[model samples]
Target: MRYAFALAAVLCASPALAQQPTAPAPGSNHDARPQFDISTGVDFERGDFGTGAQVDKIAIPLTAGVSIGSVRVSAQLPWVRVTAPANVIAPTGPLGLPILVDPTRPATRTTRQGLGDLRLGAAYDLPVQGIVASVRAAAKLPTASVDKGLGTGKADYSVGADVAKPLGAVTPYAGVTYTMAGDPEGFQLRNSFSGQAGAALRLGGSASAQLGYAYAQNPIEAGEDDQRIVGGLHADVGRSLSLGVYGSGGLSAGAPRLGGGVTLGLKFGR
Candidate 1:
């Protein structure tokens, strides 16, 4: 009976050991894997102007990466169709003074439909053993039309760092990001700083939940900040497949919005 009990304990621990994230020294591990995550969902959001709009975005995000020993390299591509209102700010601006000053312009509706921005970025994860810490840089390439109510078609830059620490039953992580505008004249610049702090809960085997808060500086457009509560879930649907969902809820009165997204992914390699 003693031998049988020991065998059973080992069997139950095997799965947990296999699912744990790689644990390197306090500052040694840096790269993740080449994983593809795709999510298509609707965002019921309100703009800085306190207007409500529902836009459906098909986000195909791909993260191809590899960590050698403790060094890491990875890239991610994000395509989104962020929808506001019909006559909303005329997509990209430089509007006539009349339109810019008129309070009724945003209230008008227009017949326009199309894609938004295309983002491509690369990151080098810094070496942090035991605990994980890395700096990431990204760029947003304008692919949508800035004219016909599509997008700004202007490039943007972002820089940030993230840190993760494991404690007992949970892992706590936090990070901050800053965005710079390219063409402040032709398009709206998002001059904001966002920070998120969350903890991960491991559930027996292949599932986990992360809940945290994200706060952003007041957006360029008054009354629009990304301050919200965020919750995310990850589950291994199969041996090679995983699913995730995330939701954000606004915290303030100005254009505070609520939305959620779902992700489906297939991973390969070790």
Candidate 2:
């Protein structure tokens, strides 16, 4: 009977020994995999810009990536809609195109729809024990119409690092990023910095949840800083397939009041 009890204990703990639960955020190690992933989602946000003026954006975004060993690469393409007061940018076309005018335009509301910027990024995981860390970098290309107020017409650069530690079924992580933007006419956008901190819980063998906070400094001179609370979940639905859903609530005036996204992915390798 004693031998039987010992055998049962070892069998029950063996599965747990093979895998540790971790968070599901990109750039964090809690749920890192050496695989290819393709996902898509739509996101929307509304913000009050003061004086009864408001702005809104809706975006459909897609991302594709592959990770092999310690290195990962990805790309992004987005379709976006922007609605703002004409005082910001007046409409010159039927498809919601924005035409930046002199200081004399009317304050009527205008809307524009177009492709957004394209993005390419990569990350490399460091060789470390216990806590895992990665170097991250990305670039945003001018793919959207500048006259339509969809893209900056210039490239943006970003670099950052993220670190995470997994403890049993939970993981905690943090990261910081710095972005450099190109200057456009009438706007002197500054280089900016942002930070993220989060914890993730593994619900079972195939699902996980995370809660976190993100803060970013304003890149435009007239823009305010943004801080937000974020939460997300990830689950496996079938062989080589998964789903992710995430949302954010703004903590500062610079952010949209509410925002969320969903992603379905096909994964390989891992």
Candidate 3:
């Protein structure tokens, strides 16, 4: 029953019903593969908190990509809104109860209702035989609120490598990313390093699943590290459409794991 529920959850996670560019970007193929490939999806994530922690947030991401020669570019814009039910701290005093207040007042906290982060970057393939290797560099623009629930308001940068190889029916991949956080205005967070590894499995021609792990450094002195194991399912539903569902769980209490979400993806052109 647990396996069945997990399978069902994977199937409904994201839209993998569309076709993607088989070959690398233009100059990447030394043969000019495809001009562009675009996909857009939304993820509804539920995160589990610690003993007395509360965290519930919804994020919608709109993404698109272009391949101009060996240079491939993709952009992701996310809109997030969160509500932490038990995040409220109240005063416990004499006459029955003290002052109790909802830290995240949705009605009054709608001010943080805009785009979260803007990511822009490009990937350049490194010529290799029987394998896929590339270097990627990107910048995360401060578009979301670090304060009032909107954005971090601090710009960040990331550089990493993408490597992939096929094994029987699965194509495994690994990557490492480092980000530098800018100064804070309201609640500017600290900078950290993140590492991720995953793979895409070909289940016939219209379906695939990506499973991986991610680890991030903790900026808070009293907190543990952030570790995540993520999985994503993609399937082609139509000629130019796809669906996906993604989920992640915390391997240990060192970080806030237990996260799951759903996505819908669309693609057009060859």
Local accuracy of candidate 2 as per-residue lDDT tens digits, 144-261: 7766666557677777777777787877777676767666567676787766677887798778887777666666556666666767677788888777666666687654466665
Pick the winner on lDDT between candidates 1 and 2. 2
Candidate with top TM-score is 2
Name the runs in model 3 displaced over 4 angstroms.
1-34, 48-52, 85-112, 186-191
Per-candidate TM-scores read 0.68, 0.79, 0.71
lDDT of 1 by residue, 244-266 (tens): 66555557443135545555556
Candidate lDDT scores, in order, read 0.42, 0.56, 0.46
Give the TM-score (vs. native) of candidate 2: 0.79
Residue-pair clashes per prediction, in order, are 11, 1, 32
Best by lDDT: 2
lDDT score of residue 264 within candidate 2: 65
